[model samples]
Target chain A: MIAKPLALSLLLGALAVVPAAAQVKIGVVTSSSGPIALVGIPQKNSVALLPKSAGGQSIEYIALDDASDPTATVTAFKKLISEEKVDAIIGPSGTPNAMGVINFAAESGTPMLAPVGSAAIILPMTEPKKWVFKTTQNDGLVADKLIEHMVKTGIKTVGFIGTADPYGDNWLKVFTEGATAKGIKVVTAERFQRQDTSLTAQGLKVTASRPDAVLIAAPGSSSVLPETTLFDQGYRGKIYQTHGAALPDFLKLGGKKVEGTILAASLMLVLDDIPDTNVSKKLAVDYVAAYEKAYGTKPATFGANVYDAGLMLQSVIPVALKTAKPGTPEFRAALRTALEGVKELAGTQGVYNLSPEDHSGFDQRGLELITVSGGQWKLLK
Target chain B: MNMQIVMLLGQDGVTNGAVYALLALSIMLVFSVTRILLIPQGEFVAFAALTMAAMQSGRAVQLGWLVFALAVVATLMDAAKVWRSKGREPWPHGTLGLLAVAALALVLTKVLPLDRIGMFAQALLTIALVVPLGPLLYRVFFQAIAAAHSLVLLIVSIAVHVALVGTGLLMFGPEGGKTEPFSDAFFEIGPAMIASQTLWVIAATLALMGGLWVFFGKTLYGRALQATAVNRLGAELVGISPDLAGRASFTLAAAIGVLSGILIAPITTIYYDSGFIISLKGFVGAIIGGLTSFPVAALGALFIGQAEAFSTFWASSYKEVIVFTLLLPVLVWRSLAHTRVEDEE
Candidate 1:
């Protein structure tokens, strides 16, 4: 009986060792099919454009559709970790969806590189998010840029109209914090659902406050309702949108109404128009050429963020691969360490300088205040 | 808030309510005529709005092509049934009408310079492409299952809703589209200003309601639909085709939904998934009317619109909660006042 048990243990050990040279797998969870697919489709496309091989090992990217739901994201993350045994995970684009899997990522000791722009994803560097990293610039940084512009323009009071979800909540919190820090009084704050077709009531309240400026924090084209309502209501106050308005669809949807509105956006959005020596210029130009060449359209900022994540992963994987082979508990740990050690890597969105204390290795340098002028994005002077 | 603010909010509420009333009226019509809830009503709205967006961009819309293809399949089905059951000419008159409409839409899509055409004409073309989808969908998906139990039909409607949503996503892509307003004019009424689009929505809703009244009371076909709704077996005994009535109800529902989409798309961005939430709100209004009376449903939807407008001012985060919770008291009152009756097959 002892001899038979020893032979079974040896057989199991040999089986585990046989696939030591297997391809490195990266798990990706994106909202590829739901309402948030506005951002997720581009994210998936960017990941596909990444190099098929990394660190001399063939890479197998397993992409899952999360439908922009937190539960779906968690399930996809679990499947990636337990079933596929991926070396690292790439994304789940929306803030809430990305938030759903950070704790699981930490507990599993697997590295997660989220391409979403919410600071809370890696804020305070909590224990549960020790293994989590994000490639996108923090919302707080963009909020600061917005505040700086407001102060420079001598706008003292601002009103807020935000969505009712996590994206809205995150922006409201950060923008409020940033505004308060700069002594700008937020006169009134209003909320509406993303699917809401009417914002007359909210717009009325915001206009009633008579603030110097109104900040609309809703994401994507949904921002049009509140903005258009305010415009129709004859509110002449300066209007500002969040970085979420960086999409060209916003311009198309907003038409003339969004013209003259200001927002802090990733420099990648106006890469070609920016000064030649800008930090993000070179990387943004390269990304635009590669992406537009492949997909026949310029990638939105959401896709640029994901491309930054891909570059960050490429920069760190070679270092991780030097220590441990792929598809092992030890390899995942090394990858996490390697991701944390990624420093001064220029990306399409920013120069990533990942440290133990800051998983999102980006700062205010990556953002620029851009306005819609003459039906196109022009960097605000 | 001052009276001016109240008046402004009220104008906005009325505009939004008008659109909701249209959706609610259609939902009530379909439910009364056919027991199955029309879950995919919102999908029609989104599809219609997006089709208009495509036309505005001068791209030939695939919606016309889809309608043509669907009409072909529905005609084939109708012909097969007529051939086997009636032993007559297999050509369906209804199919002929649908095919003509489809052919007209396709021809216009090809020949018309959409950019050169006015916005009103583009909107008309969009509605034309969209309205026929209602009967065609009813014929293809629900006609055969018309006699199924309400629960089974409900399940099938939900499945159809999911399929349409997926199809919408594929056809429209992930981006949201908004069309230019039918009218960009604005006028002041007292201290409040009203957009011409709001006036357009109100005018369209009232006109549609009046038309529906005339159709139900004045037209023989409309009376047939009403009779079928009142007593399916009795109407059948009187030679009113229950199948035709069912198809008519669905077509009206689809038309109403698409009209609402056209009216509201300029006011708010219309995404593929937006229709579900907007239509669900309409369903809520329909429920408040006990899903029976058209006038009451319209009133309920207007009340919902006003309530939403007011609630956003008071507590924006909980506005949806406040609107939905209004159902509880209305439902309790309904239960207390009305006697329960079992549904008849």
Candidate 2:
């Protein structure tokens, strides 16, 4: 009688463990409290709004804060992969943070969805980079659009000022290539530290070059400094900023100086102007409304990048679920394959059309031309 | 670059150089008196600027609460120290003063229309809110370890800087801030148009430097502090409290830092983490003095500012590289010139 009861109890225990074992686990690492907190805080806040249940499986997110340090990012990635056994990972917010962990994610066969700015994380598309995918638009995509606008406006010569970091470095590389191809002469390129107290010398140099337009490529509010300095120095032709200047702080800090600035960024910046027929419009609206309700403020485009990462994972999890159980190595590998196979999937930022070669699968629909007029972002006519 | 560019860059250099000179003097003051490297000197500048920015935007300044909280912690620490020693030593000297200042700031923030107030009042209020932090921090972090070795003090100083930076992030969000310019008028001088704010920075820096010169030369407390810096044990035997000297120097440093912040906030954006690099530049200035002479340090900082400005014009990408590379030769020259070995302990 005792043996029979033991066998029955063991069967019940096995039944209890099966469902718990099948739950999908995802790891999220963000620089939620440090230098990059402007980007990381929104991404961290959006983590709560990510779908808890996706593709008939309950998804569990394990979040970590890297404090904007790259070494801490690697540690977080290792802990998540080794201890939590997370099937997929998202974020490690800044570009350098994400770039440091691509090898670890690949070695563990876990897919990483990085919501960072630099395209260097995915470009040169090495074997290890295959496990990593970017949710933000590529620098080249945004640069191409800005360069086209410059051409349309008959801007022949351009001056560039960017921060001396990877974000600026990549923008300079991409903008120079595109401008050169379009036969626009690049007159001067100056760089400044994000924490620089003054940009007077750079502003004077760029103004002296007398380019038809000046392009600035610093992220967040630091982008405002160069533009304002140029304004103060009487550079009047035109100013073109990169998508890095999409934050609301850009307007608040730049004030009257940035009144006529133009840039191309995600549709989220000009959501009201976007037609309802656009693929990403409805989702972006819903996200903005939900985010505003939750946080009492409109979410920046950086937040949408992470939310899009969630959407991508939500769309791909079911396909991955069919091949293997959630806790095994096969499941993580299958998830990576499924994410690559995602096509025509709409996210809050843009529609994803992932392939083997392109991990950041955004096209023209991902960006909209925006200009700052009278202290607000307006869709460019 | 032509004469016009030179004038423009020179103006920029002098404006920034003046701020760095103030910071260098304060760093030198605090280091000589306390044997502690003031790594967090720039945090005061950042906090004061952010506080000023918050006021300008009509937001209630939150720095008052931080001041109040730090003051309370400092008081508790002081009380604990007294209880442990079981002596009738006087209770913490500035706790009451700090608390009063904090409370006054909090009340003013709640009652006043911060944005409508003139820039002068906003600056004064920002200074009031931030200056007390200097003494409170000295009490809480450094007072107990005042007699520790210089290396230990340096390590502890770094730890405090890290903590304050994290606290800064919590207190002020990660966004950068710029305040309204002191004045909008421009001064045209020979090929260059100088912003009135630049003139204000230079003027304030000179005035403060002169004021410091008088204080150190005329005041009894200042002479006592100087004596302590010259010989700690001698000053102690002469009844000049080392602790008092430390707190006093920190207060002066904090005041200088906040003034620098107010002056420069209109010129550039400052983030919660911006202080380290700014103060590091000042530290570089301090090093150029071999961490000793005040006038040499001030001159060194001005030279650094000019080098930084000209380098930004010539090779923008390598501006920082060029500026920092200057320190190598200064260090080598100082080491080669001064062969006398003094015991650190």
Candidate 3:
């Protein structure tokens, strides 16, 4: 009788010592509302679905809505760290907003994982934060993909219309570099402030050059009409738009004009449509299915990245608790070490190979070229 | 050399020029009487149209447009009464009254929960709020202010803009704007390939311009406003209060802005700060017309709009590069020429 009671007590003690059986806290900040509300809504949905997708340890989500603003993102990050006391933080959606948090995230030794932001600020900064990791492909990959597709499609001469912000600046640089590298000629490139009403000058100049295709980089709904005017004016050249332009809101704004517009998007968009039987694929599918069942609309790239981002952080906390003592820099570093060592772990999006040099962790091949056929995304051949 | 290419450029210019003329007239009429460059004229245009569209933003509002138009006119009338009542009313006399009306309506317009922003909703909201507003405001706020010199009113116009933007920020919340195309009720016009809404804009703007030309050149009331703008005190000494003509001018200017708002609303998207941009472009157009010539201002708006399309069609970035390039050099040359004439005067 004494032996039986002692064995039961020992079993309970062993369970308490095991790290997998323990709960972990992680903070997430993303745009859940505002003009870019459509983008943030998806990320928020995907984040909630990640733990259920993982059959093992349950993750406690501390989601803070940044309202898609940079200032809000900064404040939320501080709140999440001090008030929420989250172990690690994930996401600050837009490139501009994400850039605002880089210095603070590194200084506080709070390891941050950027899900979908893509500007030049996170990496190659004067003070590169080794603690920071990004999972979303940036302008370079998008531009390179466009150029490759253009070259293959025999689009020698191309024109561009872009928004006038840091986002547009990155687009111009990457697009030009990619086109030049691929031996494609640039006909003309024009920049406009976000508020400008007409794209006529830029449109006319580029159309006159006889470009085989036109590339647009504007971030908002302003460029849609000028884009449509391209067809109405009888410029039969193909149009290749960036992933930044791949917004459902654009279709609503642009109407029939967005019907034929081509865009580069993440592999996650076509994830549900594709055939996959593996555990990771099954997990992602089941997660997406459950998420959609709970919330009507299918999970978008924003949600998918954050969901994977949560999973990535979830995997890291166990190693952080295992090899070292809690509340120490050594423990945080080892956790960071474990994250960098992440390889062959099939994520919701794809196999994430997070390394020191590669923060996006995926290459150009990870993306797919899709077009709006009859107002729905169709795989482009 | 290419016929299709030529047609495209031509069509683009024509459509752009029409919209610009309406905007120019709206600003020019106000400027002539008030001698105040109301830079936020475009915002008025956008707001009225946006409000109207937002009110009837579902499937095509077969009879909604007429109802919206009436509502706009009534709101304008109320605004006129409020402006006329200022100084005689309970509130301390100033722009505070017009600011209150504009502020209240401005917020109400932006916060509407429409699934898809219909054609011209932004423009409509701007116009509806501003049209009746100008007369009311002229009586309450601008009567004494305009009695000052033309240049002073110009500077004060900056205050007007500050109030509009600040109120807009407070009420609507900061978000960019968007609108659904009028493709649902769209029927192509031979070569134009425009929506029924766009065609409606073309027709109404043309009719309004034709009517305006007749009224200004023929009507007695129109002549009185013109006299007031030329020499305010002299006009009052003759018989007209100059203040009364100022009221008429205010009404006409607001009406002009509203009409343009209606036409332009169907074509483009509207944002909270869209007024500032519209004001700048319209100013450039007015400058092209010497800022005193309605016909010239109207033409300038059209020219600039066409030039934007032309540049965007041919340009690499498809932005407004050509308009600025053309505007800067011409403005410099015109400025020098005008200085020489002023020196002689």
Q: Pick the candidate with the highest lDDT.
A: 2
Where does model 2 exceed 4 Å of error? A1-22, B85-87
Superposed on all Cα atoms, the candidates' RMSDs to the truth, in angstroms, are 7.3, 7.3, 11.7
Model 3, A197: alpha-carbon shift in Å?
3.6
- For every prediction, compared with the true complex, DockQ reads 0.33, 0.37, 0.12
Model 1: colliding residue pairs: none
lDDT of 1 at A209: 89
Per-residue lDDT for B48-161 in model 1, tens only? 888888778665577777678778878878878887887765454576698789889988988899867988888888878889989988888888988889988889888777
The docking quality of candidate 2, as DockQ, is 0.37
lDDT per residue for candidate 1 within A100-188, as digits (tens), equals 78888988888998888788888877888988888887888888889999999999999999988888888889889889989999999
Could you tell me which 10 consecutive residues in candidate 1 chain B have the lowest summed lDDT? B87-96
TM-score of chain A of 2: 0.93
TM-score per prediction, in order, is: 0.93, 0.95, 0.68
Candidate 1 residue spans exceeding 4 A from truth: A1-22, B79-91, B103-112, B340-344
